[model samples]
Target: MGRPLIHRSPMPGLGLSMGITLTMLSLVVLLPIGALLLKGANYGLAGMWDTVNRPRVWAALYLSFRLSLFAALFN
Candidate 1:
C-alpha cells in the first residue's frame, strides 16, 4: 500500500475541547479569585488582615473547618 489509513475520533479534537474547558474554568473560577485579590489590594493589606483577624471571622472560619472535617469523615 502507498499509505496507511489514519483513524479519526467521532468527537471534537483535543485542542478544541481543551480550549473550551480552559475558557469555562477561567470564567467560573479564576475571575472570582482575581476580583477578590483586586478588592483586597484596594482595601490595603493591613485592613484586610485586620478584617480577617476579627473574632467573628475567626469563629466562622473555625466552624466551617470543623463542619467540613465532620462531613468528610461522615461521608
Candidate 2:
C-alpha cells in the first residue's frame, strides 16, 4: 500500500539529514581527534609510540568497552 500524497512532503529533497549528521560529527568528533594527533606529533615517533602503548591508555579503552557492554546487558 502507498502512503497518502497529501501527508507527504511536496518540496524537493535538500538532503538536510545528511548535512546535519556530517556537521555534528565534524564539530564534535573530528576536530578533537585532529587536535590530539597534532599535539601528539609534537613528540617524536618514539615518544608518540610510548604514549600510545602505555598501560593507562589500554586500561581506559578496556573500561570504556566494558562499561558500555555492561550497560547494554542491563537494558
Candidate 3:
C-alpha cells in the first residue's frame, strides 16, 4: 500500500501555524493583487493605457525614477 495522504506531524500546532500563514499570505499578498486585476479588467486595456499616459502620471514616474536612482547611487 502507498503512504497515507494525511499523516500525523511530529510538530505540535503545525496545522494552526499553517492556517495562520496561509491566511496572512492571502490577505497581505493575494487580495490587493486580485483587486487590481479586477479593476483592470473592468477598465479594459485602452482605459488602463489612457490612465497611465497622462502627463501627471508620467511626471510622477520620472520624479520617482530620478529619486530612486539618486538614493541607489548613494546607497
Over 4 Å off, model 3: 1-34
TM-score of 2: 0.68
Count of clashing residue pairs in every prediction = 0, 0, 0
Model 3 per-residue lDDT tens digits across residues 23-68: 9999999999999889988899998899889999999999999999
Q: Which candidate tops lDDT?
A: 3
Off by over 4 Å in 2: 1-14, 72-75
lDDT of 1 by residue, 8-69 (tens): 77775888988999999999999999998999998899989998999999999999999999
Q: Provide C-alpha RMSD values for all models, in order.
A: 3.0, 6.0, 6.1
**TM-scores for candidates 1 onward, in order:** 0.65, 0.68, 0.54
When summed lDDT is taken over every stretch of 10 residues in candidate 3, the lowest stretch is 3-12
Lowest summed lDDT across 10 adjacent residues in model 1 is found at 5-14
Q: Give the per-residue lDDT digits (tens) of candidate 2, residues 1-75.
A: 997667656554557877889999999999999999999889978999998799999999999999999999998
Error of 3 at 29 (Å): 6.5
